[model samples]
Target: MTSVVEHDTSDQFSPATSPAPEATSEPAGRDGDGRAARSRVPALRTFLATAALVACAAAGGTYVVTQRLADAAFVSLEDAVLTADALPVGSTGAGVVTEVLVTEQARVAAGQELARVRLAEDPAQATRGPRTETLKAPMPGTVSRIDIAVGGVAGAGEPIITMYDHTELSFEAKATEEQLRDLRLGMAARVTGPGLGRPVSATLDHVKPRVGADPLLDAPLTEEQKVAHERLTVVLVPGTGDVDAVSALVPGLRYTAEVDTRTAVGRIPAVNSAG
Candidate 1:
């Protein structure tokens, strides 16, 4: 309790001379544990994003494939109309139809007499040269039309008998500009005529460039145009044998044709144009 000693004022200790250490802890992302925790969030996000992207791509691919499957495919037609124009027995000149022997729908043999063209001269046209009429056979087919009458004048090469081998015909299918590519000279074909619902196997005889030539093929477009009105015609001959199928096929029967399709066989997918 007794004595007090006073120190010099200039010798006092200042707060700056004894500064305290900074109080800092490790930051959230500084250590390996912190870094690992942070990395997990981004990895999860990436997985979710990738899954979503894959799903979207799969949907798009499916849509494209479905659309292509529904596109139009190539079809082969075989149904056709059986028709024939009877041809004259001979290459005889023009003559008068003196004796008409065969009637319409009359079945005639190969050498049966069809009509007798008269050589008798007309009293009015006696000044003209002598007429030479001769006997002719009806085309060896069931007579369908009898256009000429007795004593009627017949022109040269006139179709008195319309004859065609429709029992079984070989069609030379004409191709359109679109279906003209990649076709072999003897590609397989399928045919189906009227009265037959089934498809018949056939061969592609040939693909004619043009449907047919009018009187003016070599001439310019003005005289005649061979513009295709419908799908190009493809000729197909039925597979060998079995005349019974064609025997029932009456002439003038409407038939459908398939160049390479047989309904008996399943419908084929169209070839991809991309490849």
Candidate 2:
């Protein structure tokens, strides 16, 4: 009877123990699971470090390429100026700059209109109103100056186009009279000096005498009234085919003009006005 009573008491307590608070507890999930958190830290650190290294490598490559490009080949100039002067395109009539056909520093083709002039001043008596046509370039060249602005009135004979001559320019290099005989009117020469290079394929245009010797070249040249001159001027034709390639040798690019006296430069048809 005693054993039976003890067994019955144990069975009744089992139901309460199954639903106790101690039955469910998760400390690892709540208190920052140690192994899981630590493993993620190493992976995040590796990703950040890899990204930094990749960025640094890209920057280094860019630096090397830029430096090499700067050191590469190109022509250099010194103390050069445009040979041509401000050329007038409009007729001798007072007019307003009505239309701007081109922009400053713009490249113009042969026979391209640069601007349109409309006569602002009326004549007391006229056979016909002032003749107007869009000003066109006689030869291909760059616009060096824009003297008149839009709506600005210009007097008679005012220059409309300050067209720098784009045709083959004769480079006037002063060399000794001894060099004059050495250079024939049609002989080939190399012209390279302080402001020229590669002997810009040159021809002895005509060994003309200069008015006076360069004072800088000869200090005593300025002292004499009857200035003694002994210098040969040269005309050069570019070897490049087109105006674009020729433009690479921009105006006022003073290079070392090396004269290859033996090499003869061919005459361009455009220079003779046949083209």
Candidate 3:
């Protein structure tokens, strides 16, 4: 009777067996690779952003450099020609020129005798002899032209010789109104041309009051054209140097002038000192 009752006691008393846990479904290395690729996306984005920033900075730097260079002063070269101040020498009294002492292109000093004029003898007073007078150069210069020849009669105060002062040598240049704005008195200049053994030094001296078309033009022009062609005349005097050397450059010789526009700015200090 006890054996029959013990039938299902083992099933009730034995420890219950838990069902085995289900296996997780996943691909090999897929999760790690996906995590790695996702992490690298942020780094790649950061690198691209940094490169853009650098490119922007370089472009900005280049623009700033170009602006500075554009503001710097520049040397300007202009066409010019050598010229001089002229002085006329004339006879003080009316008479016939008997002897000519100086010829054209000859250099003379102040008060130097240039010619001798003999006054006509008075017929009413036969006893009076012809009065001889000497003509003298008014200033030191070179004879540029001769008006009267030997034995030619000249009137009183008539200019017989045209002379150019050796000390008044200058260079004349023509420029537009805009170009003249950059020039000023006392600015340094360098001149060069044919037969000029070396570059000559000069200084800006004068700016003429009149502004008009070139006086040497041969053709006529309309008013509008003339206004367009108007230019200012600039005069430059010789700088400190040998006077004879400067005088060697004759008038009407073509030359070029390099004008320094740095007078207002870009001047070097007299000395560079550190305290």
- Clashing pairs counted in every model: 26, 20, 0
Q: What is the C-alpha lDDT profile of model 1 across 1-275, one tens digit per residue? A: 88989886543576656668786566633786877988899999999999999999999999888766533233434345444444544225576776767776565676677766655455788899666555555435566666677767767666555444435555444444456443333455555655676766665544333335453536555422445432355555566763446545666555555443322232222221111
TM-score for candidate 2, please give it: 0.48
Higher-scoring candidate on lDDT, 1 or 2: 2
Considering every candidate listed, which one attains the maximal lDDT? 3
Model 3 per-residue lDDT tens digits across residues 93-211: 67898888999878899999988888776688669788888878877888877888888998887877778987788888876666665666667877888877888888777666654
Which runs of model 1 end up more than 4 angstroms from their true locations? 1-74, 78-86, 89-95, 104-107, 122-134, 142-144, 166-168, 172-174, 211-232, 242-244, 247-252, 261-275
Per-residue accuracy of model 2 over 1-275 as CA lDDT, tens digit each: 45544345665577765665664457856556777789899999999999999998889988988776543321122222224444666645788888877876677888998888887546674767665656788878878677787788877768776767655544544444444333334544334544343345544454334454356564544534322343334444444433233343445545433343333335322122211
Question: Candidate 1 at residue 70, lDDT?
Answer: 39
The C-alpha TM-scores of every prediction are 0.48, 0.48, 0.61
**Residue 128 lDDT (model 1):** 95
Query: Higher-TM-score candidate among 2 and 3?
Result: 3
lDDT of 2 at 47: 97
Model 2, runs deviating above 4 Å: 1-87, 125-133, 190-200, 209-221, 224-229, 240-244, 261-275
Report lDDT per candidate.
0.54, 0.55, 0.73
Per-model RMSD to reference: 13.8, 17.3, 13.2
